[model samples]
Every structure is written in structure tokens, then in C-alpha cells.
Target: MTADTSMTTVKVTTEARDRLAVLAAEKGQSIGAFISGVAERLPTAAELDERDERTRQALKKFGIALAISERAEGEALWAALDAGDDEALLKDPDA
Candidate 1:
């Protein structure tokens, strides 16, 4: 990997700076390094939306053409999962 030795300053509120510094110290990283790692790992709303669409597309490709038809259905699915009844989600591909 090519190493680029460059530095940039960012301004934040004192509270934010202190909080970030504490978090960074806990992880044994400098503030800049910690922020860079977070940026690399965290997904923005648009990124999440794209991921959701791609997941739906993959599911559709497997013949699960119907997305959860309603919010209630989604909640029910979650309830099933919480109760360890996830078999409700499995279906014969031909059906």
C-alpha cells in the first residue's frame, strides 16, 4: 500500500471533540484514524436504501416476488423471528 503522509484539520464543538477523543483513546487510535474507520464502516441512508433494493432484487430472482405487502406483515415476520418461528418465512419455491 502507498502511504500518503498528509494532515488536515477539522473543527468541531468542544463537547464533540472531547467525546471523539475519549472514544478514539479507548480504541488506541488517533481522532483522525477513528473518524476514518467510522466513515469506512457506517452506511448512510442512501447506502442503506441501495442495499435494501439489491436484497429485494436477489429475493425476487429466487422466485420470492412478493415483498412484505404491509407494515403489519413485516411486524408479524419480526414477531415470528423473535419467537423462533422463522419457518413461517420459508416456502416452497414453486408455491
Candidate 2:
């Protein structure tokens, strides 16, 4: 079978299993579906690193080329954007 069609088993403690069952019941999802959802929403180290790089690129594009180590300015910009200010990164990228 191809990797896409392969299946694997994971052994968990009874408590953990019961917890998963409860969560699945609450969501109206089968254990398989619930597990899949959990796995899909999780980000790997590589994904986070890539997102950081993308953030840097986006900042640079907007003329806010602060180093990655300097997260204060970027966090503020993100906060403004989160607060519904679309011009946060657009108005003064140099700021």
C-alpha cells in the first residue's frame, strides 16, 4: 500500500483514551476524525520557521525591515492589524 493509504496504530493509556473519547463525543466526531483534526491543526517546527520567514518577508515588503530578533515593532504592527487597522503595516513601514 502507498503511504497515503497506510494505517498505523497508537497505544495510549486508558485515561488518555477515555479523554480522547470524551472530546470526540463532545465534538460529535468519531475518534478517527477527532484525532485527524487535532493532528491537522498542530504546527511543526518547520512550519513555524517558515511562518517566521514569511513574516520577515512581509515586513520587508512593507519597508519594515527590522531584524528577526527585534520582535517589538512587529508585535505592535500585528497587534494593530489584529485590532482591525488594515493600514498598520501600510501607513508607516519605516516606523
TM-score of each: 0.57, 0.60
lDDT of 2 by residue, 11-95 (tens): 9999999999999999999887798788888888798778888988988998987676666667788899999999776777564
lDDT against true structure, model 2: 0.82
Angstrom error of the Cα, residue 7, model 2: value is 2.1
Could you say which candidate leads in lDDT?
2
Q: How close is candidate 1 to the true structure, as a TM-score?
A: 0.57
Q: Which segments of model 1 are wrong by more than 4 Å?
A: 1-5, 65-95
Give the Cα RMSD of candidate 2: 7.5
Pairs with steric clashes in candidate 1: none
Q: Which tens-of-lDDT digit does each residue in 1-95 have in candidate 1?
A: 12666877899999999999999999999999998889779998788768767877898899877454543476577888799986968843335
State the lDDT at 53 in candidate 2: 85
- Which candidate ranks first by TM-score, i.e. highest? 2
